[model samples]
Target chain A: MIMTTTAQATKTAPTTTPARSIARLLLHGGTVFALLALIVFFFAMRPDVFLTFVNVKNILFQVSILAIIAGAQTVVMVVGDFDLSVGATSSLAGAVAASLMLTGVPIAIAITVALGVGLLVGLVNGILIAVVNLSAFVATLATMTSVVGLAYLVTAGTTLFDLPDGFNNLGQGRLLNIPLPVYFAIVISFILWGALRFTTIGRRWHAIGGNVEVSRLSGVNVRRARLLAFTIAGLVSAIGGILLAARLGSASAVQGGDNMMFSVAAVFLGMTVIKSGASNLGGTMIGVAIIGVMSNGLNILGVNAYVQQVVTGLIIIAAVTLSSLKTRQR
Target chain B: MRIKFKIAALAAATALSLSGCAASASSSDNGKPLKVIAFTSGNQTPVGAWWVKAVTSKAKDLGWDLTMIQGDFDFQKMNPAVESAIGRGADVILDGYTDIASIGSIVSAAKDANIPIFAMDSSTKETDGFAVNITTNQQQIADATVGALAKTLGDLKGKTVMVIGHDPHPGIRMRADLAKKALIAAGATIAGDDIQKVKSPASGRTEALALVADYLSAHPNGLDGVWVGWDDAALGASKALSEAHSNAKVTGVDATSEAIAQIKAGGNFLATIEQPWPKILDKLVQNVSAYQKDRTLPKTKFEADDTTLVDSSNAANITPSDKLG
Candidate 1:
């Protein structure tokens, strides 16, 4: 009788779940729909310039840095932590990498060192939040301030220049008519998606975030999971810094600071999409694309740049609020 | 037991309160000096350094306490900095205006407070409420740099020259437009066909390096001379070209230390238009001092300095570093 009851419960669960999931889909799916509408509208308005091959390529290239940073931000947020330091870390990594290249260091060695610096910063954040018992918000904010100061100190508050020709190619070169940075983003996103969806470590992260005390009682090694999440975030952010430096062909203290908040906003807005309240890699890609398209579209339409920022902020807030309401109802 | 706990809590609270008060008092009472506020943007740049030096040097001479506020090139921050200076009863305000339109509210507020503001570097035409607008004649500087570049190039009739600068900066844009006009009038063909627009780098150094590399790769033989809208841009371009082993002659406005050094290094930077900031700052201070002594001192717009073309021969004579606000 117990076996029969279990079978019945399983059979009913599938049927009931679809209805609830459909509502969630609408809540999350609306952002993608809106993005598509905006793209079509802009294309129709300025078919000549907006839909050109070069412009499309340019949009992807421009959005690559923002997308990579936003992807890391998603992972940080999934673990119920915020990383305000990602932007500063990116700038530090880029500045250090460019300075190394300017000093005739090999590109590969400079990249490795840059990634190591990012990891060290991440470890500091993880220790502060997990061991010292400080809130991630406050801990990351402190790190952000210090990292910016360190970047400024490293560069002596000046832009590093005269990078080798090879480094400039990273910004200007194209393979099969697609930008190198775009390819980098795609490869990173694939690995991130696999880790988040199929790995045991991913489960642990979700469990710890869902309920920290419960996971600890369950012997889930919550501290390790949290640390790993942050470490991964740091590694990805450093990669973003490297690509940004390559694209700019030089690095300065303020290189990536402007993109930090926007990246976070993109990640938050991503959570409101097809995955509903859940942070998913696919959702992040869509979120990044939406932002990229809108920005490019507005630029093509000749709308004021400042007005575009205002519109983007308002749309992100609205989408997230709607998703939050749906989650509460469920 | 409860009374003992309460006593301990009270003692801790008292200690905290006393420490807080002590910290506040020390910070507030370090000096009761007259406050003079100076506002500019981007602490890392040479311009920021020049402004700080000029303001502090003048303040020292007048025996007034100076507070330097960085606006980060945001006009939004400039308004609040001015308001706060007024709240602090600041004796004088020295500010850089990003745009003439953005300073209307700040100017009106300063007028209401009866505080004299000395506009530096950039200014608005609305001098009715301000003390003085002391600016380097940017149009003249642009024309001089282009003219110098044309002379060096020798028959720029069919040669393509690239003009690089920041278009959002009004002063920079004004100078760039003037230079373009001057170049065209001199029979030089501007490179506006392919990558003709001013390519501003996300960062100055990157822009400079990319520009040099890209320009050289595209034009191997080096067409006409390259004209930069600013000295720093020229310096960056020079660094890139030097690294690439290219001999493209470059010219720019603003005889900054780096630009002069590049010229001295024989990196193909022919000349730069020099603005003597020290002399300009003295004129600014003189105007402000006169206004303070007598409110009726005639409100006047002073063209503080004209641009001079400094090449390798004369670059050595120009002071590489001087305090200018």
Candidate 2:
């Protein structure tokens, strides 16, 4: 119903000049162009460190976890829900996986159980929101608190660093000069992009988010849809947590606590880039790269770490403002 | 129900009277009541666990009445923690956090209340720490490490070095500052413009890894040595140097097991100045006890923890920690 109104509004809207359309396109692709400029500038300044294959690999390796979390966040945001508990969910999963590994659980079984924890948390989040009718924010927040507590409980309030070498290899191993995590991130994003583009469940989420009452009246199975969306978010958060623990060769109660900010920031930034003014897997990945480059590049340039933070905050504000430019007209 | 209620009231009254006697006894006689507000909660279990264990055992050893408050690493939580400690009628307070600037009003308020505050790991103020200030002589550690780096290169006359540290507290900044002075005194050039400060211990490793890589990129083979204030920063710098295959030597403080193991394995990490943190806590407890008996603060405001320089030669005999000790 909301899509129909949007279609009508666009049809009735004033026509734009070819020049104006091209200008809009250029403005929309600013992030892509800005990334290129940053690369060229850094390369000119430091060829050996900035331009090397190893550094490129390092950037990919560092940002790989954030990129995966961002993809998970995009789906939930598209459905007009927030999973604030994802960071804690990741920590809980990591704690469970690492602890299990130490207790002589096979790596394969331990990882599967770790993923199961995420799915289970997602089920709880889904039930609390879709069936029990709690606001997404309040529900996920409750889970986040409890899950963080569970993380500490599982590890007995200490960091677990005594992981088997095989698990460490998962975090550090590279295939064909690329880190294993980078592959996981790329594969997850592509799979999500396909689902969002080609599936009915994915497309209907826009309708549900736009007008939930109308979608329910139109037989949209609103509860089931929301439940599935949350489940997917939880599953993906598990993947991110497991990989992060694997990469660091350590898991602590605080492992995934700060990732919510990164994931949320990346999704919001992606909205401005996609020109759709909504979350998309492709756009989220691009946003992740922009953030990754900014962090890696600023560090490479010998900028004070605090100054890097200021620049990042300004960039986030600019992104939100850019996305709002045309929306203000509506 | 009425009989049970009467019994409960009588029990609470008796308990209150006994508690009153206990509080007055501790206050009037020996200074046995010490309330400790730790920066990290015991639940954090990794970063601030040792401090908790040392202080707890020391409180018992000194026969002090201990009331512990966990700060949970939050600044806002501290004001209440302080107020509660004051409310508990503690004779004195032991603190592990160092954000004196932000927590100044609260600390000053405690001073106004006549409850003296003793700080741990915070810089020594000659008159500030009511009992005695126990702090690590960070400059000496920094200088010692820098001297090691210079010795490794045979001479520091024309070499270049970088000092990497986190500036969450004054001690870390002091260490980095002293390292720079020593490097310059040895006729070495300071790499880049100034010391690279990490934001905190939480992300210290990642930040160090990236910043060191950046520094290495800018200077290439120009850097001769690197000095880090803490083990995490040292680990990060060591990784950057080793991965880059640079010839620069790395030195750091805190003989974290990983750092010792790395040094023993002949990795890029050269040497670390070890300050056994428990020793400082032990001394702080003793000084505070003596102040109660004599009614006088120490003549010297500060007591320093002894430091050991750990390298491949001595790493075999030292214990290593996976996390920063």
Residue B245, candidate 2: alpha-carbon lDDT:
80
Q: Can you list each candidate's DockQ?
A: 0.10, 0.32
Predicted model with the maximum lDDT: 2
- The superposed Cα distance between candidate 1 and the true structure at residue B40, in angstroms, equals 4.4
- List clashing residue pairs in candidate 2: B257-B320, B257-B321
Candidate 1 accuracy as TM-score: 0.68
Among incorrect, acceptable, medium and high, the docking class of model 1 is incorrect
- Give lDDT tens digits, candidate 1, residues B221-310: 454667777766776666556544666577877666666766887767888877766676777777756654543443465444575778
List where candidate 1 sits over 4 angstroms from the true fold. Answer: A1-25, A47-52, B1-42, B53-119, B126-130, B138-276, B285-304, B307-325
Candidate 2: how large is its RMSD? 7.2
lDDT of 1 by residue, A159-273 (tens): 6656776876776567998879998888888888888878988777777766788988999988888888888887888888878877766677777676678777787667777
